[model samples]
Target: MKAGKLAALGAALLIGAAPAWAEAPSAAPGAARIADTATDEARLMALFRDDARREDALDPLALIYRGTAPDPAALRRLFTDSQLRAQRGSVIQSLALLRRIDRRRLGAERQISYDVFLAAKREEAEWLRPDSIALTAVRPFNHFGGLHIEFPSLMAKDGAVKYEDSADYRTNLALIRAFPTVLDNAVARFRQGLASGVVESRLTTANMIAQIDALLAQSPEQSPFYSPVREFSAGIAASEQPALRAAYGAAIRDEVLPAYRRLRAFLNDEYLPAAREQVGIAAMKGGPGLYRRYAGRQTTLPVEPEVIHQLGLAEVARIQTGMDQVKRELGYGGTLKSFFDVIRTDPRYHPKTREELARGFAEAARQVDALVPQYFSRLPKTRLAIEPYPAYREKFEAGGSYNQGAPDGSRPGVFFYNTFDLPSRFLTGITTLYLHEGAPGHHFQISLAQEDASLPDFQRFGGNNAYVEGWALYAETLGYPMGFYKDPLQHWGTLDDEMLRAMRLVVDTGLHAKGWSREQAIDYMLANSGMGKSDATAEVERYIAWPGQALSYKIGALTIQRLRKKAETALGPRFDIRAFHDQVLGSGALPLPILEAKIDRWIAARKAG
Candidate 1:
């Protein structure tokens, strides 16, 4: 999973906008027509910049995440319904302007931008429909990607927000004071969900309640929100420190903690009883259609749930064969199912301490870094850091996740590992997990795009799940050529990780589309791979909380792999691995179809040369 405010911004862009070269062309000959085309392209570029500025103004957090300062008033309005309506209206207007542009007038690069921007607006329009918002806006959050989980991290010292000066501290203090409104609004939305029968699942409701309980347990001084003021930056005068600390503590005690308590009471007393026992969204009112929309939006393709389910099954079977081969090589004397049990229960494969786990990942990073230049021609300027999830969050988080750094390299990207259940954490997965979440994965893909000033902001900062997660998943395969998988244990780990993505294809579709119980999904995962029971349960609940998202991993990786094979087969010895990689990452994240089309064009250009 990708964490942080910037990741949310990327998803918002994917889920959400555009502009005009809206005038009709003149009926002039030769030079006059060429001038019209150039004018249209120039106008379109201006429109892109203008729309991006409006978006930043609408959500000041976008600016903060990109290392730019934002108006403090805009920050206070971040999560309100009025803001949501304004964003929806913006999408509608942008799409209308985009439709007026003449696609034939643009050159190749502009044409690609035109297509991506149009597709994003059209998808956002579908999601913003009244019927769609009825199902989604009412259930504003879940345990997985909820603001309740992400907001604290965003406000922390290591998070996206800056603390360079006293003014910056003052801005952060104002943001913290405004957090209560966001929490109260969530309570209002949950009530709406209850009334409309679009409520969250009981499992998710329970998890969220537990999370809030953890937050409320902390005193004002210990709160993550107070972290910024704990150590003042050099820019703050000695005279101002005492008052700033007192004000922050008062905000947490008087406002933040009380709001959390109120939200907690509502969930435990009112919402939990109302939350559905059935985990899948298919069980809710208008759920099936909502699931279909989520599936389409997430994958960027019109695909049937049953077809994806079938594809997942085939991939799982193919991967299990490889698992069986690894089992034989390890001299295991039992069936694959029994082998899974041994791997899960074996103490040697599990880390004894958090430090041990961190060391393993750090070593993996060192090894992968040494070999990176052999695989790719370009690298990111933004640095990557490894850290464990905060204590309050580790219990519910996945095995690992990446949060992007500032666009200007002011902050380094962080790879957060889970150390809550140390015994349940597998040391075998360190290399593969680091490859997927850290270097050459999210860290490289996101940082490289943000560093390039030439691309439009939409291409630089906006992306869909299919391309973003898919590229990370594809990065895992690079382990083979890099030789980390040559060690049989590491090879087994890679197979297990691949199995996780393959199983997501089956398990996610099964839970949402086929009405599989949460337990059923967990049991299937345990039976198929070496994952621990705790990890497996977390994975199933994640799918239940956010449907259709898991399907992107394998769906995306398979597409990229197929395209690479096509390039290799066509070019024969002329194909350069580094050049192919650069082509893929060059334009940032794109919808699957758009990426495929772009790669095909590159192939033709290379062959012609």
Candidate 2:
């Protein structure tokens, strides 16, 4: 739903930094190491490890991102322009080194790694260009995608940043102290965007203003950023607690809150006024090219926006027909549009209270967990916890989302379901939502990759939208095999959710590439699916905020589903479901082409066996 780069920015803005670049690694694959002396396997592994370490070193906030201790300089450095260039230079160098590897000498498994690394390098190479960086660099933060929204989650008491001891509190205090600089930089970036005609949409700017206002409404102790102070670890002595609390209070009042106020004022006084009156990216300068670039990176396929738009239309129609069939089967007298209205309006379909919604997700989680063992063999050892979205973020967030844990399984993955608007949150979608965002969806794909020590960190932690989101979307279809979508209503829920993804393909391209107005896009979604106005609006705004991202869900899911069909057709009875899954998830998050090649090879081997 969001860009990974923004997560880094969230931490980057939190921590301090330097612009130093270290020398290249000692061993150069293929150029220096021969296959005779060392297997291609060992060389590639070393190459990958070196690449990861180099990246981690260059990123002072990498520790914050990976749930490790903050760097001593983390609080000192924001994403200074020089530092951004330094990071890009590292990627380019890594790309050059990676291409030096001899693919011919690599074994089949190593070949996959080679392809992934090469593809990543090439992709990163595209983003390094002045125009590419300028597209996002000028507009560094957005209401939906960047540090402004994500900072709370990173700073929350039970959030990604761990609070274990006094040192941890101090690190956070330093991050808090450093925020004004980041916000000032954000203002500067917004000014750059204004100068370059790359400003965000007016709608986006306004929403961001509201987001800031919400934060400002919270008292110092209640501020999401102040949570660490409120819940000081029992490990700390009571004698020291008051001082720490006061320090946190002072920082939030003087530093953090004031920074947010500055950001809010900038959004209101300058940025919002300059925001584009037009809704679509196509309306902005160089937006068409930028949208195309995003479409490529997001899907990791050579798909044109026109092709995506048409594909979306076809998918929308097909899914609608399926929904019609379900409606007919369910003996509904009304037309499909009427049924959609019913679906939206029915009191029974909507939850009565936030607790009911939370409990609903909890119950669905348990039921989905029961079905996981039969769907595929492996279950993530990393526990999945279902909870409501934090109060500050719920208004802007989707119905649900997943936050992955550390690879080592020391921390459990969290599935945050929005219980904000209880009545608008339909009960019908609960089961499918859990299946998509929880078990066999994000938790399984993300946690399994991290937990697999055999895989390199790149495979374990790194991900592309297609494989990651696609696998989760594909997981939604498993409801039938798992026997959960049996009730025609629940079945409709699956279709609605699936239709949401399908419609995303149409609506995303429509809004971003095809020049569909926000209202136009929202209307198209409401007509096509059972989603209420609120979710539809938020989603349309999301596509606007993060262009081409919505395409990945349906596009990726279809690719995986198509590959499954191919495997099932090729091996027939020999196509073991568990084995097929193992092959897919075992490789970590791969690009569609790489995943297709790997799955085809697996199918061939299975047939021979």
By lDDT, who's the top model here?
1
Per-residue CA lDDT of model 1 for 234-259, tens digit only, reads 88899999999999999999998999
Candidate 2 local lDDT, residue 176: 66
Q: What is the per-residue lDDT of model 2 for residues 1-609, given as tens digits with 9 covering 90 to 100? A: 212121221122212211222223534333364323376667677778777876776665556657875554543445568657766766755654654567898888778888777777666656666777678888877878578777677777887777888888887777767777777788887888888888888998899899888888989888887888787788877887899899989988888888888889888998887888988888998999888878878987767787778877877888899899888877887899999898889898898988888888888887887767776788888988888887888889898999887666767899888877776788888888988889889999999988888887788888899889999999998989888878887899999999999888888888888778999999999999998888988888888889889989987888788778888888888878888899989888998878877887898788788
Global Cα lDDT for candidate 2: 0.79
Residue 347 alpha-carbon offset, candidate 1, angstroms: 1.1
Question: CA shift at 152, candidate 2, in angstroms?
Answer: 1.9
TM-score of each: 0.93, 0.92
